[model samples]
Target chain A: MHDDLYLALRQCIIDGDPEQAIELCQRALAAGIAALDAINEGLVPGLNHVGEQFAQGEMFLPDLVMAGEAMKAATAILEPAMQKAGARRETLGKVVLGTVQGDIHEIGKTLVGTMLSASGFEVHDLGVDVPFETFAVKARELNADVVGVSALLTTTMTGQKNVVEALERHGLRPRVKIVVGGAPVTRSWGEEIGADGYGEDALAAVALAKTLLGK
Target chain B: MQPKLEILERELIERILGEAFTLIAEPGVKVQAPAAVELLAGAGARIEEGVAHIPEALARRALASAPREFFLHNRAGEAVVRYGGDAVQFDPGSSCVHILDPATLEHRMTQAADLVRLVQVAEMLPQYAAQSTAVVCNDVPKETGDLYRLFLVLLHSSKPIVTGAFAAHSVPVMIELLAADSGGREALRRKPRAVFDVCPSPPLHWSEFAGQNLADLARAGVPAEVVSVPLAGAAAPVTLAGTLVQHAAECISGIVIHQLAQPGAPVVWGGAPAIFDMRSGITAMGAVETAMLNVACAQVGKHLGLPTHGYLTGSDAKVMDAQAGMESGVAALMGALGGINMISGAGMLDSLACHSAEKLVLDAETIAMAQRVLQGIRPRGESLALAMFAQAGLRGEFLKLAETRKLFRSEQHLPSSVIDRGSLHAWEQSGAKDTFARARERVAELLAAYRRPALAAEVEGELKAIVGEQARRAGMEQLPGLGT
Candidate 1:
């Protein structure tokens, strides 16, 4: 019965049915299944499958977005139960992401955020045109393992460098790795700016984040 | 000429229109402007909670009142662009915040110099029928960015402009500036030099600013192009057909309000519709499905016998690579074959986030090729070159024939120097440049050849004064120099 529940939850997420995903979580909990077991065996695998499909180009943005919604619904129900039982939900890492200051481009950063979350990282999206200090402050507050900076223009690449400087100044550079990506951002620029890593696109971002965490 | 393409059947178009008419009355459209609501309410529309229920007869009547075609005149007082029929004109994409610098091949915040260069390039290129206020100069204050771009375009080029007003209040000043350029308000009306693009928020919502612009542009006798964007899957519906229904409904509502403002002010059925790529959560402008949406929606507009416009010749690729070429090439061809009157989105890249002058010139080549295809087998004199073929006698070399020399220029589209049709040895001698490198060279050459179209000194001073006055009102004391 637990195995069937897991399959149902995974299928619900793949189908992008958030309400069904939450109800299945509740039903699994009512049936005396452990919350962490439900998350690891069901929600995580569901997100992983969705991510794989997205990478393989079998699924598009709306499907992935729906899957994200479903995963959130399942997590919302299971997370509280896990806390009550004194168990913690496993995360790959925590990341704070934003488009750098003076660059109002949001799609690239938003894509990276969604892909990271689907790959098991907890993400705090600070949104577009985020100032440098905000990145460090948010990273320190969240105790994030990674902070991804995005700049779509060459002019705004300075904002990414400023973010790295702020992270070092806050004494959080050692704990939090910095990853940068945008249209104009290159691997050489990443090295020049003292970034921990670089992503050519959103899929590469997920891989870079994993390598940064040594996962 | 190439054969025209149609994505929607006549019956299906009728059904879509019928559904849109019903949609306007049923759930209805939300109008945020009290003045627009009053206009619709006065025009026999039922209003409740800011939503106006327009009747089918009222919509039909409005459509009938709007002129089927109108012309935008150039500075020389020549009607250079017609907004109806099978006229296919290209314009560089508008309002991009960043420019893809050809020299460094990097994106940067657009400057006033960038806008000026863009206009100069478009002014020189025969491919673009009109020049657009292509980019927002970030060097200037944001409040006056839109009108400021237009000001620079007017200052730099003699071509009629495709532009928009960013603020509702800036509309009258912009009109005044155009009038000053054209000698006066009455003369500007008689030969309007610019068409303002007005937009409505998708899913049947028109903002107060949008309504005000539409009403003001209508009352001023300036042409207004309604750009209604509906993102299929995310904003409208997952299906393209459902999105088309929403597109028609939005456009119909826009026209209802526009015609209500004035009985017969010109408004084009224009939109930028794209499929919501579910995986990336992007409105994929480069996708074939997105191009189909534009074609199909324009078909609905054409069936209603209105002037139509669409966003095409755009790409989602971040770089000027193969993906950009393929996506933009296909979109441009489809839009051309689709017969959209005023096709925008040329020179646009990264899903319209960035503009490149190199890409603009290259896309013009693509448009030239599309125009050749549109010419579709002109046999001339009711015969298939019978006399020339008879003289050549099948498979005979026509290269030396006098007929070939005389007719070749007309029959074939001989591309400009930008396109490389040379021997490999010649290419190697010419710096071993790829198309991008060659395009960069061409851009420099064009800029070297560019001369700012002459304007009366008094008129030029007046245009500058108006822009400066508006910048001051917006809390910016000085207008940023165009850096010409």
Candidate 2:
């Protein structure tokens, strides 16, 4: 019976229904199921499935975002219960994402943020026209595991390199990884700028974050 | 020769108009300009906060006052480009920040030299009736960029320019520069040397800057090409027809203000409408649906007997590849066949983010091909080559005859040396260059052959002085040095 409930919870996450996923979590707990089992067996597996499909090109950003929302809602409900039972919820990693300074392109960075969150990483989207200092400050504040910088113009692509230097200047580079992607950005550019990884698109970005975490 | 591609039925068009007016009356258009709000409110429009609920009749009346056709005259004071009556003219796309460097095949920020080279190429091409302030020169201050681009084009070519003013204050300054070229304000108004493209923000919003520019263009007697950009599935409805209604309403709102500011001024039924690619979330200007929207909207504009324009002959490809050729060629043909008056946005790549002079040369060929297609079959006096048939009678000796010599030039579009029509042996001997390489060579040849049109020394001095004054106003000591 609990297995069937866990399956329902997984479907709710896949369907991207945060409300339904939270209600399912409540029903599972009311049925005397362990909160850890609900998260590890249901929500985590569900998000992992979404991430795999995204990496395999079977799912897109919108679907991944919905599933991420569902997982977040389910986790919000389960974390308190897990704490009461002397356990804590696990995460893949934390990510800080934004379009670099002087570039206001929103779509690419937001897509990567959504995919990272869906892949079980806690993503903080700093939004467009973000200053270089802010990326470093946010990474330090959130204790972020990865910083993903995006730039759509060649004129502003240098800002991405400056972001890497900023993180290094703040002494956060040793602990946190850096990933860069945009229309004009390439893998060689990422390497030349001392970034840990580079992605051509959102799926590759999610995979890069996962690899950085050794997941 | 006029060719049209019609999509909406008569009843469907009527229904669309009804729906459009209903949309305007309910949610109305958001007019951010206080003067525009007052202007509409005084003209029987019901104003609720920022939105102006225009009556259907008021919009139709504005449409009536707009000229059915207007001409953009060259420096020679001749009507070279018609903005009505199934005329088709193309100009290179505008305001791209980067140029695809032909030497290195890399995209870089456009400089003063790049813009001058672009203007020279466009000036040499007979296919381009007018020139545009195509690439934004990064060397110039952003405040004075628009007028400086206009200055560069006017100095390099005698052609009429399709330019825009970024800030409302710059509109009059650009107009003054054009007046200096045209001799005076009266001469400029009588035969305007340039048309300013004034745009409105999409999804039923016109900001105060655009509003002021429209009114200024109207009162100054300079033509205002109202470019309404609607991004479907984001700012507009997902369906094409639904998007068309919103486009019509937005254009209608612009017309009302433009005509109210000065009745019987020249205003184009122009827009750059494209589908929002849901996956990429970028405005897909190269999408077939984007071309379809242009054709359909122009058709509606023609139905209303208004001058029409569309953004076409552009591609989303990052380079001048097969995708660029396919997208640019197909859209150019569609706009021509649909009888759009002025089709802008050629020679653009990476979704209009970059410009290429080589692509401009290639697109000139594409436009020439589309123009050939629109010419249709010219029946030769009902003879159907009977005179030639009587002499040859399938003997296949026509190539040796006088009629063949007389007819071949008229019948065939013998492309320039830019297009490779040679045999394999000849091709191999020419270093086996690709289309892009050939285009680069052609670009070099065109620039080498370009002769700057002579202008009056005083007028040239006046234009330079105006640029210098504008630059100083923007906190620059002088204008950027003009490059060769």
Candidate 3:
């Protein structure tokens, strides 16, 4: 019976069903379920399954968007109770995610965010077209474990290094774990920009973040 | 559709083919790598002093046995396309990232969910033919990218898939996937729709993995595509002619290997060759040199009577702006005119590294326009305006004539939104939007309109069980969401 609920929740997310997902999540929360219990038991497994199916080509974008919203909704509900219980989720680490300045491509960032969240980390998505200042300010404000910046184009790849350079200028370089992603980013590039790590794809990014946090 | 090129104009095509031939005949292409050289030497191709020149006669003999057209079946077990005529085939190319938020430049691992969305989008659009570019996992540890993409495409759509099996070791698993699933072995073997792409690394080489894949694909009765990726200034000589010679040598050598493995099995004359930008040291997909290499080489491939393939239709333009449209549009146009039978790399951006969801929608629009262009002009009977104009009398406006409405839709390739046409009042009423915003809205609408497809209860169970086994083996004790 619970497996059905679990499958439904995942399907709802992959379908991008925020409203229905909210209702389902609310029900689970009302049932006095452990917040971590719900996440570990229901949400994480669900998204991961969707992701696997997605990788297998069984699911796609609507499913991804649906899954993201469902994840967001479930996480929103899970966070309050976990905080009350003094049971902060044992995350792989914290990641500050953002798209670089003058560019609004966020699919890479969102995928990284979803993967990070599923991997058990707190991700502060700074939305799109974020300047280097926004990332530095937020990393400080949120106390990010890693600041991951993504840029899709060759022209905007410079924006990736700009964030790292900004952290340096602000004298916050040592404190932050800087990572770069998107299509144009390579390990060589990450080295060139003095970023701590670089991920060619989402799966690699998770491993990179985990390693940086010493998790 | 445009009238067929006249027999008189066929001479021009012959000239183009002859030009490609002259280069290959003279100053024979340099063959690098022992695997390719040995393979060519084994298959009756002439090789001397490390220079491999596949005689035109041999190319013809190989193509004589090559199948001109084939069909790929969809999920419902229906053949969805007849791969001939002016039909343009699109498939998911090898990509590392699927642009989820193009505006934010955010990407996620192209997971199963992304594959599902891509399949839906590809199905709805007129451009795509095959079901893949599906990467198997976003988080799984073991699966490599090429194999992963293949697995995902297999699961998501019933459409015949277009995939390149990477790293020779994965071939067994891939063959199992194509053969082992719900369908029995004969059903799997008989269908033979997954046309595997085998690349000969430039200046002329096939790694053991690719050589092995060619043998495996052919022995299994599946068709083969001889793919070459010669980056000018890096892989081949910087000249277009030099690249074409290298591309020909690569194909001829590949054909020899493929046919040697299993005689008369199909093979494509395929390449994704491009130029390395001198400024950034990056491979430039948008450069005119890149377009010329693809087009000119395609002519050579056709000259050998082989079904040609090129990984064109991809753009590196960062944003979904004018640059994206112009770059993708011109490249797609050239690819179409060059008589490329299968053009992969749709929905790709940033020089085939990143793929954009929004751009996929926009690129579909551009492909629609290119398809219309290839249609050319029709000089059909009454279709010519002579009779209509005679009836309408002098000074009659064609716009006001009754035949205008009757023939306009047929004559004029009407675009479904993404190309807006509205009077000022109607335009203002409908939200005065440019192409990108309108594209944004279209993407949202398509996404919103999507209904999650229900897999068979049994298939869903199998998929879940497979994932569960992996997670549990990875040492997660309590299954996620199981008790909830």
Best by DockQ: 1
Backbone collision tally, model 2: 0
lDDT winner, 1 or 3: 1
Please provide, for model 1 over B390-435, each residue's C-alpha lDDT reduced to its tens digit, 9 standing for 90 to 100: 7787788788788788888888999877789999999899887777
Residue lDDT tens for model 3, A86-205? 987777777899999856565668877877876678888999789988899888888787999998654467788889988888777787899998765677778888999998767678
Top candidate, metric TM-score: 2
Worst 10 residues of 1 chain B by lDDT: B475-484
**Could you estimate the TM-score for every candidate?**
0.83, 0.85, 0.62
Docking class of 2: incorrect
- Where does model 1 exceed 4 Å of error? A1-4, A19-23, A52-58, A75-215, B389-397, B475-478, B481-484
* Candidate 3 wrong stretches, greater than 4 Å: A1-215, B1-64, B82-86, B98-100, B106-112, B134-137, B142-144, B180-182, B380-383, B394-402, B424-431, B451-484
Report the C-alpha lDDT of model 1 over A81-164, residue by residue, as the tens digit: 999999987789999999998676666787788788878889999998799999999999999999999997554776798999
Measured with C-alpha atoms, the lDDT of residue A57 in candidate 3 is 64
